[model samples]
Target: MWIFGWKGPSGFSASSTAEEVTQGIDGSALTAIVTGASSGIGVETTRVLALRGVHVVMAVRNADAGQNVKESILKEIPSAKIDVMDLDLSSMASVRKFASQYQSSNLPLNLLINNAGVMASPFMLSQDKIELQFATNHLGHFLLTDLLLETMKRTARESDIEGRIVNVSSEGHRIAYSEGIRFDKINDESGYYTWYAYGQSKLANILHAKELARRLKEEGVEITANSLHPGAIISTNLMRHHGLINTVGQMLGKYFLKNIPQGAATTCYVALNPQVKGVSGEYFLDSNIGNPSAKAKDADLAKKLWDFSCTLTNPK
Candidate 1:
């Protein structure tokens, strides 16, 4: 847990908690949508953001779970404006429905935190016939961001404030397959390996941000897009698929793995920190800029991903 003492240029480190990173920051007028807000780091991220006065919309696959989280937060901060919306990232139909509902509410979107993800799950296909990890982690977010982009742009333009999009990637991105994306073989069951698939999805998260940032910059939009590694928080259900890993983690995790607060720190920092103003298309770790694998930095791959995602998420 001492990933804390080692500070970065941001004067924060892996040990910093979400509340600590966002202290003194007032987000009273901002509105944010955080996916997977019912559990793990997503819960902490939502809580801290609400604490900072941001109107938070919890987009979770489970409405009951999301309501529970919302209630718990409200119990602590009665003034916090929070809403729960059902969203199943693995289903493109659900994403569109959620986006439509959100837009219809006419809520201003200042921050988008793509924090929900599945890790190292056994091979499975989403309702759309896409690989589950890639579908939920990368493609879901891509479409959600695309759908809400107009609102974010309008908010920035009308309010004269910067908009931010944060993608929660992982260090596991460096562990992907030789092709990085496995684009041509995305659903090839015979070739699928759990870790590689998860890595590929995480890598996609970074590339999505890179390509999105580039496009936003070209358009001269005030919105910035970036990705981050939220550290390994062993208590989360992210590793639920691996019985052996969970066993080992229970024994040795508390000694080294990040606690929930630490895991959510970088997210809160990247989302609300004034120090991050104008930065985009970068990878962050421990609340500071960190290097990603060369493959994760490939601009052509990013552009290709953008086009590919467009086809997959296209309504027609």
Candidate 2:
């Protein structure tokens, strides 16, 4: 029963825009990796960070789409330092390749935003024969983070600055997978429920952050791992495959929820804001450390997920 006391700092809000969240933050010395950067909140989040002179690596599956996103950012901020990298989160091989390339660069990563995801799509599997949502949303990021943990730790020690990893989760995680992470059923090729699987994956994101934080703490590392819900952003085409769901989500967005910039507030806040410089393993929403469900704080499940991820990634 981990109690989450929503002690919001000054200048934070549910409606805070990405620019507002990172106002006055100097990121010229930082390097960040943002997944799902091809479009939507992922793109907007990277744009905000890049505007601050942060060298942002746009990790996406499609090179052409990534180039388009890079152009859009360059158009907005001509001085934005944006690099496009091939990262198909659905494939373990692609994830490994990206990790290898990143590690070989020897550049310290200041931030990592696991923002790529699919929602409410038809059931599918990755090339690794894992559930699509679980593989891409949670497992892929899990492996990538594990692969780069050493680099982040080294960077923190060398620069004496906090290295951050932000797992972009959703409020939807609260609705499903409440019964605990089903490690046994994770690879049910036949039991394909988009919403349920998506929920489980999102929960895994939160769990991953919690577990990573615990491990880093034990290892005396300065890299912080935190999870955040980006709120309901209409700009992200997560529901494009589900026509009715997309329509309803859009309508709800028009009526309530944050705009694209606002939706990305908590994510940007967790990634670079000074208020949470050392805060890790916490679940945030609306730019504040909000209360997660009882299940979200299950340390045991977090450890279980971490172990499962280790087996999946086979990190030595």
Candidate 3:
């Protein structure tokens, strides 16, 4: 279970909590944009950063929920600098609007956490008619990153630090077929299974990190992108759209999986740890780099997915 360039704790299990992982990290001068920051793992991750003095932009689909999350954080840490921004990742149009506004503000974005995602939900179409999971979780983030690359570059240069984009993938990526991203059937119309489709979208997150890292390096930008699996946790509405079987599976997960804080551990670890400052395009868990499936490391597939995503989300 070894892979090249993996440099996290060895044999680390998935029970670490976000508060535990970020015990001593100082985040005073950092500004971050974290999607799905309104609840669950996202909310916990935001809290961890805010407690450390980092200004965070909670990018959520619903402005009301985003504001509520901000108030909750303010209540916990009265001096916490938190802002809410509207971003519906399922729509390319919304992603563009959000990125445009953020860039216009000229905030030095040290971290971008693509933490929002949906799972095992009934099949639904995005504004562009793509599958819901893939559209919101993968493609939206892809476009948003490209849109914000300039801001990230500026932040990296000004701070002399490696900028970061953390894609919150899942271990379920193991279910992706050997062929990798199935561009032809990306919409999954003919043979759609909720879990399988969710798996494919999660796999896209990993590949997006890998490919984006390579491209940013080639362009001489000091930015790092990586993916992680937040350990299974209850309390998130990610399963809100799930069917009975999926709901049952989520209940079973509570028995064996980490709690919400525990689930957010790897995400917080990757976002702020100096130990992993230069670690890009790697899969992580439990504050440690984990080995991805062989297919997950296929550069060709990653490139293909990137090109396909650009086309889907950035039509000329």
Candidate 4:
């Protein structure tokens, strides 16, 4: 059994709500983009950020679903500032378009929560003919972050607000293929297992965050990048693609899983907490910095994955 220790200095625990971690914090001047903001932890994250008076852009693939979420937030927090924007992470074209539109809007980006992802799904190719899980979960956010990075840096410089980038990774990152990432054969199906593919994508999320943090520091940028596990959240659409055995496990494991609020707490903590002001490239869990799997902490591998991702996203 996995044991979660004390809540540490944050005074928050695995059961803490996002609102609890962010209590009394004012976010009126900040603007954030939360991908997959339609439902589950994404929606909860968006709602809590909005509650704290942040101007949140709900980046979702489904416009209608995004609108509904927007309406729901506004109904509760009558003064909340929120916008619905269409984003399909599976398509590079869509990612480019979304980034272009947001850049042209002249909005300052203070936070980017790359919260969208796919789980264990049958093997499928994206529009770019790349594996679906890696494409959506890693490459899509990689490209989106790359395109908007300058905007974030400029915003931080002008507003003197610390820019934050949070990648919602999973603990399952440890379960990837023996090689970690299959650079030469991303599309190979001979040994493909749905969970392994999912794990590879998640591991990429961590590596992407770590490398991003290093590069930003090298360039003397104030933007901080970190990744996290939201804990095993129950009843989220993220599990829609789970296999039968996994589905059964989820059902049986429901009692130990986090509800939506608790699941979103760590994200809120990492994104808004003053305690983590200068912290970067760390993996967080249960509202505190925690060590990830040994593989997740391999710096050389992180850099390698960064190079591979850049090549994929920025083909010559």
TM-score of each: 0.98, 0.94, 0.93, 0.96
lDDT of 4 by residue, 1-316 (tens): 1236356666777878899999999999899999999989999999999999999999999999999999988999999999999999999999999999999999999999999999988989999989999999999999999999999999999999999999999999989998999898899977889888999999999999999999999999999999999987546788786556557756775677677888899899999988879899999988888888888889999999989988998889
Query: How many clashes does each candidate structure show, in the order listed?
Result: 1, 0, 0, 0
Best by TM-score: 1
Candidate 4 has an lDDT of 0.91
By lDDT: ranked, best first: 1, 4, 2, 3
Q: How would the candidate models be sorted by TM-score, starting from the highest?
A: 1, 4, 2, 3
lDDT of 3 by residue, 116-144 (tens): 99886678899989988889889999999
Best candidate, lDDT = 1
| Candidate 2 lDDT (Cα, 0 to 1) | 0.85
Question: In model 4, which residue pairs have backbone atoms overlapping below 3 Å?
Answer: none
Per-model C-alpha RMSD: 1.2, 3.5, 3.5, 1.8
**Residues 1-316, candidate 1, lDDT per residue (tens digit)?**
3554888899998788899999999999899999999999999999999999999999999999999999999999999999999999999999999999999999999999999999999999999999999999999999999999999999999999899999999999999999999878998998899999999999999999999999999999999999999987547878889888888887787888788888899999999999999999999999999999999999999999999899889957
The per-residue C-alpha lDDT of model 3 at residue 116 equals 92
lDDT (Cα, 0-100) at 161 in candidate 1: 88
